[model samples]
Target: MKKTKLLLISLLLTDFVMLLQPENAWAGDVQITCDLRVLELTSQQRNQIRLRRQQYKTRQRQMNENLMNQNVTDRQLSLRHFFSKSAFDNQQADEIAKQRYANDVRQTVAELNFYHDIFQLLDNRQREIWLQQCVQPAGRI
Candidate 1:
């Protein structure tokens, strides 16, 4: 009986640890073929792309911070609702969903603009290289 109990406890601990592992841990064999450095950018083009990339990164960071804060606020509100007798606010939920959608749109536009700027900076040969090395293999239609 003691041996059976220990085995069961060990199984439970193993399951718990498996649950905490990231889903991407299973993707160790996946490889990326796109190499941005193959562009062989000139100094001026490199500087321009760097500036645009930095701006895009800053925007993304800001969006992530805003999203984290919003999630915290939502979690707190949910806890309060769970303890209270008040009904759930469907209208407020709708507003939050709208805001999230807007944020997604804004992020997508920023990403598109950043890529467009980088593409514009690339020469004809570089553009072809980017398309072949980065875009085509990624299954871009």
Candidate 2:
């Protein structure tokens, strides 16, 4: 009985440790970018990707700032004190959706441009590596 209890406790502890381990799923741009390590990029290519990523981040920040400014204007126009909480939430959601929809095309163009720049930098072998090891495995290709 003691041996059985000890074996069960050990199995439970092993299971708990496994549960704490990080998952393999790379879900975001940042995680996908990290997976670029598998591409074996040259110094020049890495530098180019770094610069492109910086530019992308800057554009995204600017776009977000514009959206925020528009949201501020929208909030200023809405009389928050008059509406019930649910009504205020609905109005805020609508405004957010409008802002996102308005910027969707620009954001997509920027992102596609960024990826295109990165893709253009790769040679055939590197491109295959990128596609198979980085993009395909990430379920992004």
Candidate 3:
């Protein structure tokens, strides 16, 4: 009985660890598809682009964490005011919303720069291939 219980616990822990793995852990398909559609490049160019993509992803994750932290702080502040029975001002709320929107725009611009850098790294023919395979579908190329 003891051995069975221990085995079950071990299995549960393994399952939990697998569940906690990051979403991008399995990106083989995406890379393969990109390689097939994009123009031929030197292995070094491919590796460099892969490294840049990873860096961009890391920066994006950090940005998301910062945004979440900011949201939590704002929510806590609102809760504190509510507990104090403070009156909510519509104007103040509107200003906060505007500020958040402006921040979102700035973040979007930064993300665009990362994408533009990736596009710039691609040769003209590769860029065209990328557009046809990915971006042009959405008329976003």
TM-score of each: 0.51, 0.53, 0.52
Cα error, candidate 3, residue 102 (Å) = 4.9
lDDT of 2 by residue, 35-141 (tens): 77777889999999999999999999998898766756555445454354554577666765675566765776787788878989989998887665555332343
Please give the lDDT score at residue 97 for candidate 3: 69
lDDT of 3 by residue, 1-141 (tens): 999999999999998886655332322112213443347876876787788879888887887787776766776786576556568777767765686677556666666676677778788887888766744222122
Please provide, for model 1 over 1-141, each residue's C-alpha lDDT reduced to its tens digit, 9 standing for 90 to 100.
Answer: 999999999999998887655432323212224567899989999899889989989989998888776666776785566557477777767765676568766766776677778889999999999766765422232
Off by more than 4 A, model 1: 1-33, 71-100, 136-141
C-alpha RMSD of candidate 2: 9.8
Model 3 whole-model lDDT (C-alpha atoms): 0.65
Distance (Å) between predicted and true CA of 136, model 3?
A: 3.5
Residue pair clashes in candidate 1 = none
Top candidate by TM-score: 2
Would you list the rank order by TM-score, best first? 2, 3, 1
Model 2 stretches astray by more than 4 angstroms: 1-34, 71-100, 136-141
Task: For each candidate in the order shown, give its overall lDDT on alpha carbons.
Answer: 0.71, 0.70, 0.65
Which is the leading candidate under lDDT?
A: 1
Q: For model 3, how big is the CA root-mean-square deviation?
A: 11.4
The worst-scoring run of ten residues by lDDT in candidate 3 lies at: 24-33
Ranking by lDDT: 1, 2, 3
Q: Of the candidates numbered 1 and 2, which has the greater lDDT value? A: 1
